[model samples]
Target chain A: MSEVNNKKLRTKDLIYAGAFGALYIVLMLILVMSSGMVPILYILAPITVGVFCGTVYELCVLKVRKFGPALIMGLLFALVACNGAWYCFVTATACALLAELIIFLGKYKSKFMYLLSFVVFNINMSCPYMIMTFNRDGFMTRARDYYGEEYANGLSKLMTPWIWYALVGFAIIGGILGALIASKLIKKHFTKAGIV
Target chain B: MDFDICVDDSGAILKLDPRTKLVMFLTSSVASLTCYSMENLLIYGIVLCVITILCGKKWLGVKSLLIFLFLIFFRYEIVTSGKGSAAIGGLLTSLITIFLFFFPVFMSLMLITQTTRINQFLAAFDAMHMPNIVVIPIAVMFRFIPTVAQEWDGIRKAMAFRGISLEPWAIIRSPLKTIEYILIPLLFSSISIMEELAAAALARGLDSGNNRTSYETVKFRAVDYLVTFMFIGLAAFFIIGRKGL
Candidate 1:
């Protein structure tokens, strides 16, 4: 079983972590920057970001086949991007550490455990957006003052309090979709190519 | 703009020790985030542009300068023009505020990445006696980014050869296919590259347990101190002003 043969992280694993982490950041940055210009894409950003993250997570896990990659990846991304408040690093690290534990607990053999880790890892995708939660009142007030009472009210109505909570749901769906896609690609191309 | 760290030994700014560069980057990033005033942001933005241009990144410097000018222009227009429609005005103002707050920090980050080479940065970290756990991951990360870019370029060329429309519109039209064709190959290639990179790093004794020596000189000179003090002063001024001192 792959579980029995599991080894500790190596220098290569660290490199893989760094590479995949950079990939995740670059992907999200591209999407976020573009979404900023076309605000309509904002709605879809969280889920799609999650999807991209999940894909990277899956690949990282397969290649590294060890623990701590997620944590390092998340931490490096946070430090470089300063993607959010201090809490972002905390949450991202915690999520990745938890994923590492899950992969470890599953003895490195359970596909279910791996997929669960992907879901948790991808949740870090929501860290930047979480900034909105901290300044919700300020955001609303600014919207009201600048946009008009009607527009602000409409925005508030459209953005339910549970929007961030719903983002978690979107994260889960995205994670699943990304994992399924990665799974297919790995099976079809990578496994045969011996890359995996 | 190119975000990767530049290795060219051209600019006076580029000649500063990587440790100094790192300190400057950290200082600017923290200050950019902490200082909320638009005036401070503009000052920080201009200083950042000068540094970027001095570091031989003229194109990025100009691009960043233009962005800063646009932000200033946009704010001026909004403030001077009799209030426009509420939605448009609010949106514009909010965007301006966000841009003001973030652009400096972004520029600072870009400056560090664009000017300091990865090996030099990591060597400086080692010289500073940073924990191996932290240093190793960061070094790996720096190496990883460029490898991914190279692999991505290869994938793009392959797509072009295969008659896949590499345009934004085509990708937008069929994202899933793009992901399937482009990202999948990229991922597979990156997996192998990751392994090779790891092997190369291991061969260089990157994961060694002993104290390591670097040939790169990483000393803080007067300019480093001056830059550091300037940033500290800016932060202090912002905090004092915020406190109504």
Candidate 2:
């Protein structure tokens, strides 16, 4: 565990961030496809990011060995996935910035800090669901206008406040699972391959 | 599975500068997110679809348009229909709606990715006087995405050889094994690729403070301005519509 590298990011750092960022994006695309068919699956989507954050952050530490890759990757992801609502960029950037801070505080060496960084990074994964939930009023109105008042209200009640809490709760659990899995994978594969 | 990198360089969007296309993407994406009304989003969808068709992506254009229409109609049905099947129908409809809302942004990004060449994009960024730190990563990213796809194919084949199915159910069933088998290899290979890419970029003096020149000629045409204004006006119209002012 070294203190966060204060030197400027080199070309290698950018390359690491960009390449890993692409991997993250592609993995996210797969998760999105798997989850897209059912609304119930969408709530679980954020957890996927948490699941992979361990591997990604570990790779980041090993390769770039510097600060800001998380932030850069976050910005790149938002730019590529700009199809989401505008606030996505805001949230993505914020999450990355927070992850960067976490990594900094942990000096990029503490295993716990690495896990915590991922937990914060998981916040970006929650963006789409957040957008959907927050804009429920608009969606609800459209539903009511079409289905008649009774059905829309029933649909609304079905989506209780607990669903939102459940989303965050799942994300935190996913983060823990991801960190655990990543550590195992790092020990097994990354170490064998000399990647970490 | 192919990303939107230019092949024959024949699309209508390819004629516009990459920077201009980037602006169009940003505007349309923002407008789609900002405008809450379905009708406004529909208009944006139509505009994007028309552009896609004109760019010779006829099938993509048509498919997206159909999805858009289906979403609108289905959303109405989900609300008005009684509760017998409302849960399932409502679930799918809402899922599609979220995607539909971001349709224009995705379409525009597709146009850029499919039509613009990597060097052209880099040239455009260089012309904009972006720093090397930003430019190098983005350049690497453009190259990395396609390579990752290639690696993904290799991993899939190996998995198949070992009798591992990549279908969603298979993944959901044995998540840990899947990550160990599929994700580990993907990450492992990607790391090497990243190292090589970084070396290659540095070898090309990408980190130099000096100005880099390119063979690609990137210029803004009249159509670029026209498209830009059109999107700007569309955004203004949506904002005005939203405010009722």
Model 1 Cα lDDT, one tens digit per residue, A1-196: 0233657666556777777887877677666655653334564676777655567777777766776777887787667555335776687677778888988898777878887888777776666555456656645664554334554666677567666676667767777777777776667776787664
- Estimate TM-scores for all models: 0.83, 0.82
**lDDT, candidate 2, B83-178, per-residue tens:** 566567655555666577557767786766666676788888888888877876676666676777789888989989988898878888988887
Q: Model 2 Cα displacement at B174 (Å)? A: 1.5
Q: Name the lDDT of candidate 1.
A: 0.69
| Candidate 2 local lDDT, A1-196, one digit each (tens) | 1234456787667778888887888788767765654444655677776786568766775556578888888888788664446665687688889988888787666777876777777766766555547666655665454334454566566566446556677777877788788778888877776665
**How much lDDT does each candidate structure score?**
0.69, 0.71
Model 1 residue B187 CA deviation in Å: 2.2
- The numbered model that scores best in lDDT is 2
Superposition error at B35 for model 1 (Å): 5.9
